[model samples]
Target: MPRLWDETVDAHRRAVRAATVEATAELVHEHGLRAVTMSQIAKRAGIGRATLYKYFSDMNSILVAWHEQQVTVHLEQLVSIKDGPGEAGARLCEVVTRYAEITRSSRSPHAFDFPDLHGHEHAVAAQRRLRELLGELIAEAAQSGAVRDDVAPAELAEYCRHALAAAFELPSDDAVHRLVAVVLAGLSASDARS
Candidate 1:
């Protein structure tokens, strides 16, 4: 194929795949994971059953792909926050707060229905990258006396992750924000010194 034709084909494939994943997520959200069928997913995605199978082996695969895409998007959003203009501490706070909001807002039925899905290697890798990114930010903030120097950056990063995990179950936006504030306060060098 010509370069332009190849590009067009690639774009089409991505669109189809994205549509299929999104449809699967919607179905799972509405009907629960075990209740959703591949036929329903194909219908909701506006694709033929054969076409859906060409892109994914089964509903579980579709859900995994959808979850991977969500994780990628969340990581990209954090990367954007990390690169955006701000002091290191402020950027870290923004990233954590945004992360908390994403966690709270993006809960799906499949999360409870298929807890094993989280053990996927890609998900684990994404989580590791999130920790590393936060650790780097903490190290930078520590140099500027914004975060505590007493703890290793890696350990502090773990603390932040554990603290923010509560956002997934928090009752309201106010509660999530309060959790973030508490996490940040614990990280603050000023609080440590005083």
Candidate 2:
């Protein structure tokens, strides 16, 4: 095939895959994972069942691919926040706030198995990278005396993660922000010194 023809084919394949992934997520969110089927995905994606099968072996595989894409996008967004214009402490505050916001807003009704999906190796690796990113920010803030250095940065990162996860249960944006403030306060060097 000519180069232009190859590019067109590749683009078409990507479009098909993206559509399939999107349709799968929507179907699963609406119908629950156990109730969803490959046929429904194909119909929603505007592709035939045979074509959908050519792209994914089963609904589970499609869900995994969709989740992987979601994780990658989320990682990229956090990385962008880390690299945004700010000092380390400022960036950390912004990233932590944004992360709490993401967690707080992620409510949805789905019957999918979270441990199976989120515990996938790719998801685990992304989570580790996020932890490392948070650790780096904490280390920077510690060196600058913005946060406590009594605890190791990695441990502090873990603490921040656990504390901020409470945002998911918070009732309102005000509650979430208050939770972030508490997390940040706990990390403050002055609080430790007092």
Candidate 3:
């Protein structure tokens, strides 16, 4: 039953990692990055410091993993939106709007713009995939005469990504929505009436 034991051990490790990441997110939300420590996370996760170290070597590593998990969830949300109903332009607008709202409302630790947040090679690759997906969606919309033809698809995608980040700085969803509406308006085809 060596294989069964190994599987059990793997399952336990996964559970611990999930718990640690979740605890870190909660602490980060309540206290911000500076106030969160490994000891705090261990206590929050209801584990000893030694057990915490066994799962995550340090706070920075835990933060990186947490950030990755958040990005993965965001990407999945974007993909699901793209997969949903309506034309590409409408779908894209909905996706961007949803992104702005979520970022503005959530207590995620996106304030620091940490390089380790999305700078790791694997994280960067995931980000690239997200950009690519956005670009394709924008290009399709542009071809449909929905979005401005002058703006390059990649450029539009980059702007939207930056806008999503900026939206997080807003104090309220209404303010973020107004800003997003302006961006969406600018993306409209020239022939379309305001």
Assess every candidate by TM-score: 0.88, 0.85, 0.79
lDDT of 1 by residue, 2-98 (tens): 9999999999999999999888878877888889899999999999999999999976788788889988999999989988898998999999999
Least accurate 10 contiguous residues by lDDT in model 3 = 107-116
Candidate 1 stretches with Cα past 4 Å from truth are 1-9
Identify the leading candidate in terms of lDDT.
Answer: 1
lDDT value, candidate 3, whole model = 0.81
Over 4 Å off, model 2: 1-10, 28-35, 111-115
Q: Write the per-residue lDDT of candidate 2 for residues 21-137, one digit (tens) a residue.
A: 999888877877777888999999999999999989986788788878987887888899887787888888888998898777665556225336767889899879989999998
**Whole-structure CA lDDT of model 1:** 0.89
lDDT of 2: 0.85
Query: Candidate 1 or 2, higher lDDT?
Result: 1
TM value for model 1:
0.88
Checking candidate 3 for backbone clashes, the offending pairs are none
- For each of the candidates, give the backbone clash count: 0, 0, 0
